[model samples]
Target chain A: MSEPISGKSLHGHLDTMVLAVLDKSEAHGFEVWKRLEAQAKGGLKLKEGSLYPALYRLETAGLLTARKEEDDSSRRGPRRRIYKITRKGKRRLDQGRQEWQHFVSVVECVIGAPA
Target chain B: MQDLRVHVEKAVRPVVADQGTKLRMREELYSHLLEVFEEERATGDDEAAAILRANDRLGDPAALTAELQATASRVSWYEGAIDRIVHRQDETEIGHACRLASRYLLAIVPLIIVVVPTVWIIQTLIGSTQKSFLDLVSDSLWFGVPFGVFATAQVFFFTIIAHRMLRQFDKPSWRPRSIGGVFGLCAVSTVFLLVSSFALFSILTGNPRATYELMMPKWLIASSLMPFVMTGFVLARRREIERLEPWSSLEIADET
Candidate 1:
């Protein structure tokens, strides 16, 4: 099996990716993890510890808000917390996406790849 | 839940400041670990195996804790100063007391470097008897005692004010009143430190009269008042801190 993307490579984009995942749909911590893995096609394995801190930092920065709700689907466990992207989060995501695209375009151009 | 909590507690290790923050972080991390354990169990791992695997995947707890500390807003300056004094995160009460004593002594080094020369320049320019407002109050043996007593009271009040103030970041309903009480204590402590140091320097330089005139009152007041005043303040505030911190955990009172 291929090694997961190292945290060093993902560190810069973690906040943006978290915002993107939440932007698609509100998710609890685990749900967000699952979607991130799927989005990365199983290559973007995240350290479980780092992910929640990022979510918390984003929440503290006013880019996200969280609410706890009963997990009706599960019989016996704790309530699930759902985190949603705020308007500020959407704006940040747009900026991050633009930056990422620009960076990729510049790198690809240097490598003589098709646009 | 118990296992997950124990794992997290072991990882975070001696969490100081903001009980509410620590508890909330633990619960959120616990829920995430439980989800990971469930996924591992789905793959036919036993309960123990699932837990082990999940814990491994979470990365180092120490690293996670450092990151969390970095992300959290700074503790109030009063709390920061008090932490230096008391070494609040240390394991034993004796350790805390010793750390407090050592830190106060260390404060003298800074006084010698910064305060002494400034005082010398001011005194040379103004005259021998020239006194700042702090000097006049500190000069009286009678006033010095009450001033020390008042400063001691102010420290107690300011600590509460600082802790509750930081608690406001988490609690929108709680608003802090004037922080000048704490700043006032800081100012008093600074003057007290410098005057004491300057007098000590004078006595060592064969100027014992200056010691009698300036340092005696401070020593008499501070040495006599500080211990009782600090003890009383701690004892007095110990019971009432709970009502003050809405967001703090129930266990914080015991810890304090």
Candidate 2:
């Protein structure tokens, strides 16, 4: 079995990943975690608690906005702070994607491609 | 639900953030924990086992708290003002330092306003018996400069203690402990300053009579009252700011 990518190793990319997740649709904290988990397909190992600080950082930077609303879907739960990415956040994600591609190409060139 | 709430509280307890941020964090964390717990239960685990598994997946509370604090939304009005003033994108490093220094000086304005005039009046009355104008001026500078410096230092010390005490007010669990800590600090600082002033006076004049008659009573009163006075002022200013700008509005982004 392949070793799962630890969340610690993905710290720099977490912001972009979060932006990417939110770009699909606005989601509350739990839903974001669920989607990320589903998308990573067991290749990513993330602690649930670590997601909040990233959310807060993004919100503070005006890259995303959040508001609390009642979750009708949940039978027993508090109001969820639904987060959505801002236009600036979309621009940042585009930039991040381009940079990531360039970085991958450089590394692949140096490493002579994956086996 | 209650179990998840308790878990969230323990996890977020160590985060030193404003009350609003803490509440939002607690609610969000609790919501997430509940979801995790329910998912675990669906896998046939009992309530206790599901809760345990959910918490384990949430990771260590201390580590989470540290991360949360790192990105903690700053809600203090002074912090907001300072960031606005000092953190301009175009501002150079030296300009940033200078602006911060100026803000520190501005913070001590009340201290200077209260202390300088009081020191002058006391010096004038004490030196009334002096034969020459030069003697009075000399006496004022001799006593006033050191007193002013000591008073400034005391104000800063009390302000720091008061800031910490005020921060504690955000955590309901910490309120009683904070009050006791404040009183303890006040008593300790009073005693410490009294002894230090006596030593300072003796070293300056080498005359116990002069120190006792000239400085001790008034200086002692001022030094002893300073902690209470500063704490009261900080509390009052905080209340006024809260009145003007509600804590809810201090969040970085308005609700959408």
lDDT of each: 0.64, 0.72
User: Would you list the clashing residue pairs of candidate 2?
Assistant: none
Candidate 2 deviant stretches above 4 angstroms: A71-74, A113-115, B74-256
TM-score of chain A of each: 0.86, 0.91
lDDT of 2 at B117: 63
Q: At residue B41, what lDDT does model 1 achieve?
A: 92
Q: What is the interface RMSD of each candidate, in Å?
A: 1.5, 0.7
Over the stretch B1-256, how does candidate 1's per-residue lDDT look in tens digits? 4565556665543344354456567667777888888889999999888888888888777777777766656552333444544664423534544544444444444544575457656776878756664564344434334444444443444454334333333233333344554345445544554465555446454586776676767765654554344345544544345333322322322222
* Reproduced native contacts, each prediction: 0.60, 0.79
DockQ of 1: 0.48
Steric collisions counted per model: 0, 0
Regions of model 1 farther than 4 Å from truth: A1-3, A70-80, A112-115, B14-17, B76-256
- TM-score per prediction, in order, is 0.55, 0.53
TM-score top scorer: 1
Highest lDDT model number: 2
Strongest candidate by DockQ = 2
lDDT by residue for model 2 over A1-115, one digit each (tens)?
Answer: 8999997789799888999999999999999998898998888888889999899999999999998776577456667899999999999999999999999999989897666
